[model samples]
Structure formats: structure tokens, C-alpha cells
Target: MEAVVSLDARGQILLPKEVREKAGLRPGDKLAVITHVHGEEVAYIMLIPARKLAESLRQFLGPLLRELLGPEESEGQGGAGPG
Candidate 1:
């Protein structure tokens, strides 16, 4: 879905009702602003739900973290605990 939302003087854009409803955005929902840069300029920006973005990041980093920490650390113990 595409929408052409205008930015206010405060640099805030109001999401269209249809767009917001389609995306399941709620009044107090947190959105993560993502920018896509092409060359030296920003091509566009995307707003994703913070919860969804976190889940995606966790899924993406899980394997990398496991590799960095190794088998002993991946088993939920026996490594340097949180600081």
C-alpha cells in the first residue's frame, strides 16, 4: 500500500486512517524509523512497528550471536554473564 502524507511544520506526518488501519497501528504504538539511502542521498524512509522490528533483528542476530559466543555459551549458561 502507498500513501502520500504531508509533513507538518514540526516534521511530523500523520498517517492516513486507511494506512494506519491496514498496518494495525495503534495510538500509542512505537514506530521505528528506517531510512534507505541511495548513494549519498536518502531515497526513502520506512516506519515499522518497534515490536516487529525487534523480532526481526533478534531472528537475524541469533545465529551470529551463537557463532560469536560458541556452543558452550549458546546453551544458556557457562559464558560471561550480563554486565
Candidate 2:
């Protein structure tokens, strides 16, 4: 889905109704703005739901965290519980 939006005087862009509906966005939903820089300018910008962003990060990091912390600690056993 592609949309061309304008930044209003307040630096705010209103999402097109179709785009919002396609993305399942609702009033007051939080979106994370991501930008790609090309030298000194922004090449492009993307918006993703904040909830999805955290889930993506957790899915990507969970394995690495588990490896670094070991299975016991990763699974919340707290490693220092019993002697």
C-alpha cells in the first residue's frame, strides 16, 4: 500500500482513510516513525505500529537473549534461587 501524504503546518500528516483502514489504525493508535538517511537527508520514512515494533524486537532478540543469559535465566528461574 502506497500513500502520498502532506505535512501540515503543524508538522503533522493525516493518514489517508484507505491507508489507515488497510493498516488497521485507529484513533490515538501509536505509530513509530522510522527514517532512512542518505548522507545528510532523509531518504525515506516509514511508520509502524508501536505494539508490532516491540513484538518484532522481542522475536528477533529473544533467541539472542536466551543464548547470552542461558536457558535457566532466560526461562526466569533466576539462577540464584537455590544453592
Candidate 3:
């Protein structure tokens, strides 16, 4: 979706409601702004939610942690013996 927004006096721009909804963004959601040169004369920007990104990382890291820590660490930490 494409949206046109104007910057306020403090140089803040609000994302349009439709655009926000389509992107699954909500109030107080954190975003990462990235800028790049689209062409020789044009620049492009994107916003991504930090929480969503972190969630993705956690999903990917789960198996790696299990492999590194073993089954004992997976159950719990510092126990006298297995029940």
C-alpha cells in the first residue's frame, strides 16, 4: 500500500490508518527506519517493528539453544535429582 503523509512542525510524520493496519502496526509499536538509494536521484525508506523482528529471532534460536544446552538444561536449572 502507498500512503502520503505530511511532516508536522517537529518533523514527525504519522502513518495513515489504512497503511498501519495493512502492516499490522499498532499504537506504541516500535519501528526501525531504514533508508537506501532507490536510484541515482531517489531515496527509499521502510519501517519494521522491533518486537516482531525479535519474535522471529526467538523462533529461529530455540532449536540452537536446545542443542547447545542439552536436555537437563531444557527441563530446568540446578535440581538435586530427577523426580
Candidate 4:
């Protein structure tokens, strides 16, 4: 699917409703933009669902924290909580 979206003066692009619905994107959903550059210019951009990125990051980094701090400390109860 292709969408021709325009950026406003504030640099925000409104995603067409059809596009959003097709992608299963809803209000408050977070997206991550990845830019591919060739030399001096950006060649293309890709949008990734942020939750997907977080899950991927957690899979890679979560174990390292457990190894560094030990299992008990890795548990939330032994770690810092929101103040």
C-alpha cells in the first residue's frame, strides 16, 4: 500500500485514515522512524512499531542485566522504583 502524505509547517504528517486502519495503527500507538542514509542524504525511512522495538531490545539486553546484577537484583523489588 502507498500513501502520499504531506508534512505541515510544524513537520507533522497526518496519516490517512485508510492507511492507519490498514496498518492496524490506533490512537496513542507509538512508532519509531529509522532513516537509511547514503553518503550525505537520507535514502529512505522505515517506521517500526515502538513496542516491537522495546520487545526486541529487552530480549537482547534483559539477560545482560541479570548477569551483571544477579537474579535478585534483577527483580523489580530489589531495584529502584519510581519516586
Whose TM-score is greatest here? 2
Worst ten in a row by lDDT for model 2: 74-83
List, residue by residue over 1-83, the lDDT tens digit for candidate 2: 47788899999999999999999999999999999999999998989999999888877877787779987786683322233
Candidate 1, residue 43: lDDT? 100
Candidates by lDDT, descending order? 2, 1, 4, 3
What C-alpha lDDT do the candidate models reach, one value each?
A: 0.83, 0.84, 0.74, 0.82
Considering lDDT, which of the candidate structures 2 and 3 is the better prediction for this target?
Answer: 2
| Candidates 3 and 4 compared by lDDT, better number | 4
Better of 1 and 3 by TM-score: 1
The C-alpha stretches of model 1 lying farther than 4 A from their native spots are 75-83
State the lDDT of candidate 1 residue by residue for 1-83, as single tens digits. 48788899999999999988999999999999999999999998989999999888777876777789886676584333344
CA shift of 58, model 3, Å:
0.8
Which order, best to worst by TM-score? 2, 1, 4, 3
Say which candidate scores most in lDDT: 2
What does candidate 4 score on TM?
0.64
Candidate 3: residue 21 Cα off by (Å): 1.3
Which of the two, 1 or 4, has more lDDT? 1
Check candidate 4 and list the clashing pairs. none
Number of colliding residue pairs in model 4: 0
